[model samples]
Target: MELRQLAVFVAVAEELSFTRAAARLSVVQSAVSAAVRTLERELGAELLIRSTHHVALSDAGRVLLPEARATLAAAQEARHAVEQQRGGLRGTIHLGILQVLRDHPVSAARVIAALHARHPGIAVEPRQAGSAVMADDVRHGRLDAAYLALPSQQAGLTLHGLSEEPMVFVCPPDHPLAGRAALTLADVAGEPFVDTPEHWGTRIFSDLAYSAAGLAREIRYEIGDLGGVAAFVQSGLGVAILPPGMIDPVASVTTVPLTDAPLFRISLAVPAGRPTGAVTRRLVETALELRDRTPTPAG
Candidate 1:
């Protein structure tokens, strides 16, 4: 079947509405319907079952959707490959980085600068985003690569470990436990805590660490980022457990090692099972080189 027909089928399968798919493709509904019909006739299978009130994918459609997407991606990659061969590694890489990792060592800026210096034709657009969302973006081809915590096991993605920073306890300098040599989640079980929202990667690490220690963290305030968390903690609003790299240098806030905290792993992840473009490969190599040069944070 033609790639155009497959594209229409994929659009219809995803939107589940001929009208919506037409709008998405910027074509008329009749053109979309005719394309799907042509694809169905060529494949000798009914891809979708449409009714007056509802439209759903048939078993054949469900089976072909992923294959269709892969085919389309491969075709796009082929075109990109030709363009790169002619122009020498010229393209924009949509990259995502965790907000906290921007200025730290092995930072996104370092990676982008290295890539740019090596290949000025390569354009890098960096966006600060949450790790979970970034992982999904990489998996779906929305992002070429991302610097963030790797998902435990996300399909269609490859994660390369960069560095693992230990989580630490932060409290006001005058707090009773601030002077402790070492602490655990249980040490601050009853203390007010300030941290990011539940969807944050740090929050996931905190939840898992506390659960493992059989202690419940009383998150008194939910801050959007580590800067806000540091502000709240320094103001005596609550204590916080955060990556050592995320700890602020505020004179009034002290960071203590968590004796039983999870390591905040930073990884460079990319979409799996696809030919990575030249610019994206250079970016990944730069990140790996930086990771080698940087030391892991101690607890």
Candidate 2:
């Protein structure tokens, strides 16, 4: 009938003696007897058998022991959950964002704004990183979470795919194939290519696409700076393969669809096999909400 009564019943059931149960609960024996009598009357069943020499459970007591224990455990868990909520999601979330996502700054801002408005106690520190390093940073504790372009499997991280951004080929307007609707990686295999460094997230997918096509890309320039890749292609330095949304709109550079380009899958990656902190969980939820509401590609 009541949590205290159930707790008292459990103690008596386990100990099999009111005197022992009272001692275990640090209460007087008569008080324990009175509590059990009240519980039995409420349940309309006798719960214990008592004789001068021994104490034993009646049928009702045996049947209710496990259920009583369960009720107490559930009540304790409920209290813990409330206490945790009262504590607030108050902490710093060491977050990392992919350099390419910087192109869609509004989505990033919206996620942070929603998180802060709902849980003002959470502080977000966002830093830019190449997709290749985002997963490793999160797994190694250098970051709490990150928006990453993850490979199919990351050993020590959990990846939640948010959006798939298509890749395109960027070439100077005068390039022979610039006006084409779409072309495969093989078509541009021999062209002078401006690409990201080998360690970049974009480079990983590009390399896999080229490898699948059995094409050896002629990388004329490998840019370390994220902005330099588009700059090089726009200046007639070389053709580049990149997410169309990530590239700044340039009249001099024509974005041709790539038939075989791999779609960049953006995901929220967190360390695997650990309890996520309250603030980190809130960030993940907000990011998911934003991801679902935003369009995949920029107009």
State the weakest 10-residue window (summed lDDT) of model 1: 98-107
lDDT of 1 by residue, 1-299 (tens): 99999889977876688997898678999999999999999999999999997889999999998899888767867776887678656778999988662367867887888888877888988877778888867775567898876435668788888778788888998999988999877878899889887767788788887887777768889988778888999999998888877666553699888778788888888888656766677888888888788776643
Q: Candidates' lDDT values, in order?
A: 0.81, 0.78
TM-scores, all models, native as reference:
0.81, 0.68
| CA lDDT for candidate 1 | 0.81
Off by over 4 Å in 2: 1-87, 101-106
TM-score of 1: 0.81
Give the least accurate 10-residue stretch of model 2, judged by summed lDDT: 100-109
| Candidate with best TM-score | 1
Q: In candidate 1, how many clashes are counted?
A: 0
Steric clash pairs (candidate 1): none
Instruction: Please give, for residues 24-59, the per-residue lDDT of candidate 2 as tens digits.
Output: 678999989999999999999999999897888899
